[model samples]
Target: MAAQYDAVIVGAGFGGMGAAIQLHRLGHRRLLILEREDDLGGTWHVNRYPGLAVDIPSATYSYSFEPNPHWSRLFAPGAELKQYAEHVAEKYGLRPHMRFGTVVTGAHWVEEESHWRVAIAGGDSVTATYLCTATGFLSQPKVPDIEGIEDFGGKVIHTTAWDDDYDLTGKRAAIIGTGATAVQLIPEVAKVAADLTVYQRTPIWVSPKPDYRIPPRLRRLFARIPLAQKVVRAVGSGLLELLMISGVVHYRRLRIANRIAERYCRAHLFRQVRDPELRRKLTPDYSFGCKRPTFSNTYFRAFTKPHVHLETSRIERVEEQAIVTADGRRTEIDVLLLATGFNLWDVNFPAIEIIGRDGKNLGKWWRENRFQAYEGVTVPGFPNLVSLNSPYSYSGLSYFTTIECQMQHIDRLFRAMRARNAKVFEVSQQANDRFLELMRDKVGDSVFALGQCATANSYYFNQHGEATLLRPTSTRNAQREAVRFPLSDYTYA
Candidate 1:
């Protein structure tokens, strides 16, 4: 017999935790949170590499309702984020509902019972009236498909599963991929490795990171007066929103702002690297905001070090202990580190198999038709299911903004369901289509549509060459619509 739950939230990260908290507030106490990993914190727990830190300011990276006043730095380290996740879980009593080390293979909607049948890795299963998949966008690790990689007789590690026991001191290391993860890691690897080689396929735009340790006095003040912390949070959120709005979302209208941002990034790189050739190799050819940009003060400087070398040639193959370039240059290394990003369009779009009404596969439907969700939460056929990491779901620069906005949407939705005394609620196809059309119109003027992004090789562009990952609106607008969306958009029974 399968255990029954009022709601089953997948992935015990902040998204899932937020969903659980909101559901509890809606009087859905019979809940379960299933996590594949051994613990919570999601990326923060999985990624423990050196120089791991949040790219956004700490003030805006947390939940708006529960702010942490004791962040050690402006951009807090990954460990502090994990600690904060633990703190939130404990404070909200979410730990009791979490089941770690539980892998969810798939889920299917049981129309007769008006519930979801969630299949676990083993033979066990659970039934829930409502299903919410909060599995993050970057949960799946992408192993590179390099030829002869298995023949390499050296230590290999991916950024997602970093081995802390192995020492990098004096080791010759070669890293593949120069994405945002590599931006944070390359500097730390250069400091210890006797020889470090960074292979770049696409150069990422990196602005100057204004990172600094917060003083104890400021921490005390925040703890004593919550309003002071709220003021700082508002300032941080405002700056990030301004960047997103002027530089990316409104690129067609604010081309000058985008160009200015690109020039600022170039200046940051020029200040660190004196060599013109190196500067050229580091600079991105595409327009700024085509892909997600990161903040780092030391990434460009790391290449200027004597021990670090940047390789621009494409990798031809991997030998036993050396990497062969397209130009026939072979570089020997003692360790291979892969900073390759996730497979978002392929395996990560749904994260797990989801079957809605009439045997409609969510992943297949998105790939066959289009990737979209109503207000980035519910699908027309998927009743009582909320996908936190759906298409056009990510709002603003900070992920917490998206999470909170979705939380508000869920709260409003459940309240309406309760008022109607409905056991089943699903988004109408008309509403989903209307929202999709609105998003398409909104993104039509953005950088991905108007600017040159063909050379970016960004994850933002999915398989269909559509940038459907981010919501093409301001965070305030997203939040406003989350609360003010027409209740008639959904069919309640």
Candidate 2:
């Protein structure tokens, strides 16, 4: 007989941990968290490249229930995030339930048993009453399809799998992609590399990062008075909502807000880069918030350095020790760094093969029809399953907000299930369709629908040219709906 668990959660990241913690609180103790990585922290553990830190303010980045008042900076470094994850796991007793280096191949619903049979990589399987996939939005790394990249003789490294031991000091380095990750990394690499070339396919909108070290006195006050920290978190969240959430997600209603944000970013760029041509090259052709914007003080300044070269030409191919461009320009480098982002719609949509009722494949169904989930948690065909990183799931600027909102949804859902003595539950097709329509209508008013996003090449927009990732609503509204959503939406057994 396979090992049995009340709930089996794939991916032992913060999302899995949060799910486990919520389940434990609901009196469902038989849990197992499967992680492909050797340890926890998910992306925090996977990404260890220099200049890695949370783009959002640290105050708002963490779980609202458990806030860390000891962050060294307003925007804590990646190491601090790892430590925070460890602290959460230890405090919540999640370690024993987690199995590290465990690969989950797929899962299928067993109708007769009314349970999920989760398959492991080595032909072994586990039975769970409920299955939750929290594999994260950016779990799978995307390798660029540039010709002759495989034949490159020099050291090639992807940001996801950074080799910290291998020093880049005195070495010529070329970084491809200028997304949020590249924005943070380029400045650091420019400081050390003998010659640094930044390959830009699309210019990123970058604002001045108001990063500062938290004074010891302030930290002490926060540790002593938790409410003080809560106030700070509120302020931080409000700013993020006004700038990112409203300016971008609510672009139709808040066009002026978006323009103000765009002007601010442009002004920041102008202030940093003296050369008009360089500033123009750095400016994005697409509307602001078409792609995700990032905060970086040093990113613009890095290009002004003598050894740092910004290459705007399209990449033709990679030679043994040189990168050739479409403009017949060739640049030789000792190390090639791929800051290319993740494969979202293709590989990471479901993150794993999930077979639902009547031989319905979840991935296939979504691709064939549309990517959606009722309330961004439960689907119509899949019973007793919650996809944490589903379409229209991400509510606010902070991921913690999304997690907490989903937790609320799960808590309310499970409470209803327990009250009715139900063993199985699935979202109704009517509910799913209604929710999908609501999201479509809401997103129709956003920047993705109204603005110039053709040049953005953003992951937010899927293969269908629909921005299905973020929930086009405020954090408070998401939380309210999670708790107050009608129970009749789901059919319980």
Candidate 3:
């Protein structure tokens, strides 16, 4: 017989940990968390590249239920974030339920048994009445398929898998892709590298980050009066909510925000880059918020450095010791970096073969159906299975908001199941269809759909070019929907 548990969570990240804590508090003690890596913290555990920090304010990045008063800066570094994750886990006593170095290969719903049989990578199996996965939105790295990349003689590093032991002092480095990851690391790399070449496919609109160190006095005050930190979090969340409303939810009604963001971006660019040619090259052609907005203070300044060269030519191929452009320009470098981002908004990383009722593979079903989920958690055919960070479920502002909303949603479902003595529960196809229809109706007016995002090469859309990734609702609205939504939308057995 396989090991049994009341619930099996396929991650140890924020969402998974939050779910575990909520379930534990709800008297569901038979819980297990499986983490693929040798430790917790998910992305923070794996992404240890230089200058890695939270783009959002530290006050808002954390869980509202468990506020941290000891953040060192407005934007906490990756190390601090990892420690915070550990702190939360230890505080909730989640370590006892977590199995490190365990990778889930697949799961199948056993209708006759009314349970889920989860298969581990090493042939071990586990049985759970409920299965939840929180592998995260950008857990999978998107490596570019450039020609001759494998034949390169020098070192190649992806931001997701940074080898800290590899030294970069005085070495010629070439960085590819200018997304969020590149903006963060390029400045730090430019300082030490003898010469750096940044290959840019498309310029990103970057806003000035108001990052600063949190004073020890403020930390002490927060510790003394927890309400202080709560107030700060509320304020931060309010600001981001307004941003979301302008940029995502009510973009049509309030498009002045685009002008404001663009104005700031252009001013910042002009202030940093003295050369008109460089400034023009760095400006984005599309409307603001068409792509994900980035915040950086040092990325622009890095271009002004004598040792740093920005290459706008399209990459043709990679030579043994050089990167060749389409214009036949070859840049020599000792180190090559890929900042191509993750396979977010397209597919879940470390995808499991989820065999639902009637032998329907979840991956295949999504491919056929164009990736629709009932509130990004429950599916029609997959009974007793809940997936986190699913399509049309993601809120743009903060992951904490999403996690809290999802945890509350899951908690409500479990409570409903317990009240009715239900052994199995699944979303009705009607409910899934209704929710998807509502999302499609609402998304037509949102910025992602109307804001020229189709031309921006963004990850917000699926293969069909529909903006199905973001939830067209505010965080507060989502939270309320999670709690107040009727349980009759699902069928229980």
Candidate 4:
């Protein structure tokens, strides 16, 4: 018999697991999860760099329903996070429904039957009524297009797809791009490598993590008083929210705070660096909040090490044994690490080949696109398909809140599927267009639009210089939508 499911979830990350768990609790079966990797934990499984850690505090970073009490660190490491995803899968008995190592390369909408025909890389196709794409932003590595890269006689690795075989124990290392990955990785690389060099194009604002471990005594107390831990989590989440609210509402205040942070960083961080010009080279020219702010206690101080060298020259090309800069300089390395982030926007729409009404390819249709969703999950025309962290739905806020928010809207679409007994559901195109305009207009008023930050070329911006990648909706507003998905704005097909 053909495997027909109510929904087919792609990727076994927290988003997919959460969707499956919610459906199971709602008593909906006929669900299958397809994961490309041999394991779960989408980003967590892939990113195994030395200094990888969660940007958000782990207290509120987890699912609200199944909070882990035994989190060893405040900002959990990659391994711990991967374990968290697996634990959730096991705890909810979600493992049975998944087919690991199966990649759903393409999903075609069968308009005649109103079902999605999903194609696995090395297996038979499956038909699903609904398709959920959770292939996260960080899944694909953004290796820069530099000439002579293939000729380099060094072990090259992207932070997204780490090559664990290469031993960096005593080798000279070079890390390209000083973004989020570099912020965490530099300190760790400094510890192991005989000598390390960080090649830079830009600098990111570094802030203190305030990260600490969960003491066993505190864990015991929390175990005894569950509500107390919940209270603590709530308080921690509230503090994070307060920070977000202040940053969003008052752009200037956020800018000033970033400047203060930069000053603090220079005084406490860069002051110890003996070379004044080198210290200046390390400072960022863009507004701190323009690009994503990174947190690390030792990222700046890593430069103070005698073994670590910070290079500011533009990488002209890669040679067999060395990197050639624009000024005819060569920096040799035994291993090279690309801290560059994944490709955004281009990954969505046409890349997935989502052909909607009348053979319309989604990517081509929106040449002047603005990321808009009626509820941050559903698009006007693309019905029965929900994005995990779709546009205007993502924020620098906790992924926990954003994922939960998206899931709520998705639940509404699910309910509508049941309530009307409808074969397919889609957002009205007119509604999406208007919402898209509103999203662009709203974001145009923000600091990111002013180009005061380093995000000018970062994935943070869409072609129109708007940040449609992340959901900027406040948590308070999103929770209301999640509690009950609003169906009024969307038209059922």
How does each model score on lDDT?
0.94, 0.93, 0.86, 0.74
lDDT of 4 at 387: 69
The clash tally of candidate 2 reads 0
TM-score of 4: 0.93
TM-score of 2: 0.99
Candidate 3 ranges with C-alpha deviation above 4 Å: 1-3, 345-350
Name the weakest run of 10 consecutive residues (lDDT summed) in model 3. 344-353
Per-residue lDDT over 95-188 for candidate 4, one digit per residue giving the tens place of the 0 to 100 score:
8899988867777777777888888777788988788877765666678888898888989888877777777999989998888888989899
Q: TM-score, each model? A: 0.99, 0.99, 0.97, 0.93
RMSD of 3: 1.4
What would the per-residue lDDT of candidate 1 be over residues 393-447, giving only the tens digit for each residue? 9999889999999999999999999999997899999999999999999899899
Off by over 4 Å in 4: 1-3, 249-275, 348-351, 454-456
Indicate the residue-level lDDT of 136 in model 3.
85
Q: In model 1, what lDDT does residue 319 have?
A: 94
Q: What shift in Å separates residue 385 of candidate 2 from its native position after superposition?
A: 0.5
Cα deviation in Å at residue 45, candidate 3? Answer: 0.7
